[model samples]
Target: MSNDAVTPGETRFYQGEGQTQPLFRIEPGINCQFAREQASELMGYAQDLVLDGLLERKHNMIWAAHYLNALAKALLDDAELGLAKAKAL
Candidate 1:
């Protein structure tokens, strides 16, 4: 339930009660172009996997479909924000 955004190039290490230690690192940059490309790639991969029988066409399809949809939505959102920023600039 933490609403804090992770800064680029920052590393976060977590240790908690009854849990093993884990570390996470955030990448640098807000490269929207790369994000869009990645989102496209992920969507294609999900589609291929589903068609190739690697992914189930049932409940698992729903999960993969959700991720693909989410990625596309995120890419669109980022593009809109980038456009807005460019206009402001």
Candidate 2:
């Protein structure tokens, strides 16, 4: 399946002259309920990176939102699958 409809556009937080830092594209390829757990792991990595000075604060927050969104989508997909199974029965 194509990720087009599901993929969210990349974004950057904070602006102006000093905000030119590159942002990371952390789009999750989530399709199953189990895969939804990735958000927590990604958040952990983001926190570590920020603490170690590898990532910016604003950038971390942006990616954090992306991870959470992915988790939500996983839940929605799971619910849809359940509905389909129920219809079959």
Instruction: Report the number of the highest-lDDT candidate.
Output: 1
User: Which residues of candidate 2, in runs, are more than 4 Å off?
Assistant: 1-57
Candidate 1: residue 57 lDDT (0-100): 44
lDDT of 2 by residue, 32-89 (tens): 3333345445556655655555455466666555555554444445434443444555
Residue 63 local lDDT, model 1: 63
Error of 1 at 77 (Å): 1.3
Superposed Cα deviation of residue 24, candidate 2 (Å): 21
TM-score, one value per model: 0.49, 0.37
Span of 10 residues, lowest total lDDT, candidate 2: 1-10
Clashes of each: 0, 0
Q: What lDDT tens digits, residue by residue, belong to model 1 across residues 1-89? A: 11222123333334346655544322434455665567688778767756655444466775666556555555545544554554554
